[model samples]
Target: MSNFVFVLDTNKQPLDPIHPGQARRLLSSKKAAVYRRYPFTIILKHLSLEPNSTPSQIKIDPGAKVTGLALLQGDKVIWGAELTHRGFAIRDALLTRGSFRRGRRSRKTRYRQARFLNRTRPQGWLPPSLLSRVENILTWVKRLIKFCPVSSIVSELVRFNTQLMQDPTRQKEGYQQGTLYQYEVREYVLEKWGRKCAYCGVKNVPLEVEHIHPRSRGGSNRPSNLTLACVPCNQAKGNQDIRDFLSSKPDLLKRILSQAKRPLADAAAVNSTRYALLNALKKLGLPVTTGTGGQTKYNRAVQGVSKTHWHDAALVGETPQLQFLTNNPLLITAKGHGVRQRVITDKYGLPKQHRGRFKLSHGFKTGDIVKASIPKGKYAGHYDGLRIAIRTKPSFALYPKNGGKQFDTHCKYLNTIHKADGFAFSFVGGDSSSA
Candidate 1:
């Protein structure tokens, strides 16, 4: 299965999305034409159609780094995408700017007034790092709703249970008597050990459920006795006592034993902004339903699907018995518009050089997407971006958008397709030309 192809009537009015096969038939018979590449939309050439649509739902699994999105009509998943955000990038950029500013202030300069508590954050204000994730999801949702007739939206508001995850039996018999079951113990042990061998700490190795105390030597099958060890470590340990084996590294053994009894803390930092996202989605005026991380995991386990963001999205929120989903989802990386104003600077905040102007000599901005066609020149294909190193009248070098090969072309044959709206374009396994 693949994404549903968007359809439009001859008058350019929106219509119901059809299967990719149907869209192919229409295109082959010259009944429809390609409209967009990223979303794979199509438009009718001569056929007149009414504005009718089927009830559809959009499911979003929001996360700090990667968000999963899926559009479904009943039990069939028509389109799916994994949106990778640049939250860390935003954070790192701000930190770098702050470091530069601090360095500049410390250098030999006139004394300035000491600031004290002058800045204040507005209501509902979130750091750019966290807010970027919410905005990216919202932007995609808005764009999708415009193309498809989405009736309802489903999103994962809270991923994990903070209390239950931190102390699995917090409500039960308190800390000392709270013991996890065998299966639960294994999961907790793996996480506590960082999914690595407790003996060697080598990650990415196949780990085995090993007993810290030899089971033959009266070691109970409790979580405290259970630990993760690689195949070599388990074989070497055999039935030997753990104390005798790890006598050289008392600290490592003690750390492993202590951590096995304690549960890993929930990621409260990343989940802090989930409520803001939920409220923003609700403001869209759609009937929104929220799910939990446990429910999503249960749904995926019951369906026996492999772990992936898009698969989790398909399994989220009132899933049917049988659902059709795409094998390859569209990969969307949210690269924000290059908004860096600083031109050049050395490592120690010393200014090396600066850009004289923002626009190129040919009047094209740095991020504008342009198409260039040269009848007889070195460069002839489509190129985008404002990497015009030589802005001479005859030809100019163009850096391609979405990490493409840069090429040189003449300005006379350049045509503007879509102006860069503070965003970059990079897609794979879809149509390339624009409408």
Candidate 2:
């Protein structure tokens, strides 16, 4: 099933989201018109005397790479989206800019005095990369609120205890230190073992936390005793000692033993901005609730729900028996608004080409979603995707959403579908309900 479409009244007041079929019928009868294309919102032509909008709650599962969003009306998930943040992109951009500045200074050019320890950061300061993740999540929260009647926010305020994983007895508080004990151990093992099967050296497969020294054979629950192995490998080496398991391959056995003993310093690449995210959500003045990773995992496990980011989100906190109404979720990738640099620079910081002051050409801008129809040519066809502007030129690049070859097309043949908002959109389908 696809996500439900958001609806709005004549005054632009948020209303209950309707199924896509209902939305199509409303548009066919000329009762509603398209309001926004990105979130697929429809606006009624006439004002409603009584708005029958059901209050929805936004549940977020924030991660380092992607943040899952689910709009839950009661126990049913109506709309779902997975937002991919570009934090690493921002970090790389900053690094490149700094390198360019430093290179220019070292080229025997006239340089300004070095400034150090002069700028003081405000309280709760975060690196730009980390801050971008929070900002990306917050931006979607505001957008969803505007398009849907969000009554409350639920966020997974989870962190990892690297110290606990390394030394479980160091803190006697017993696993409830942000994440579940088993999950912490599994996470640490995955990092230390490079997320590959320790037995077969296989990668990208689901791994099980296998004891190197068999637990049945008196292996203690230490981080050094845990390793990861693929399902097939684990089953094949069931309860076998590490040395016995890899007796034929003595070299591989030695390597695994040595690596498992070496402690990993940063096993928990936890999202440091989880509390910052919580604080920001609290400032929204809505009833905000938080859940732990352990709680989320328990909720998901008891329901036997298949693990997807959006599925995890729906089971965030105080969840009832959930009903999955949609299997396909909107995929949103945060592509920041174009940079402000006018003079394009080369590796040596030399000016290569100057960019135009205006980004629009014939009422169309870069990143705007457009539908194009070309009568006849090598690239002749109908296309619907974001337009890549060819500065001051009449032709723009058309990137089809259906994995078609990209080609340049004339602006006259294009129709605007959705204005760009610093995000790329798509969709993916998978079963998120119980297996």
Among these predictions, the greatest TM-score belongs to 2
> What is the C-alpha local distance difference test score of each model?
0.71, 0.81
Model 1: per-residue Cα lDDT at residue 310: 78
Kindly list the per-residue Cα lDDT of model 1 for residues 98-122, writing each as its tens digit: 8887766787455453478779999
lDDT winner:
2
Q: Could you tell me the lDDT of residue 12 within candidate 2?
A: 95
Instruction: Output the lDDT of residue 370, model 1.
Output: 62
Candidate 2 segments whose C-alpha is farther than 4 A from its true place: 110-113, 159-179, 187-196, 203-206, 211-225, 231-270, 347-351, 429-435
- Candidate 2 colliding pairs: none
RMSD of 1: 5.7
Cα deviation at 139, candidate 2, in Å, is: 0.9
lDDT of 2 at 1: 84
User: Taking the candidates one at a time, how many backbone clashes does each contain?
Assistant: 0, 0
TM-score of each: 0.75, 0.84
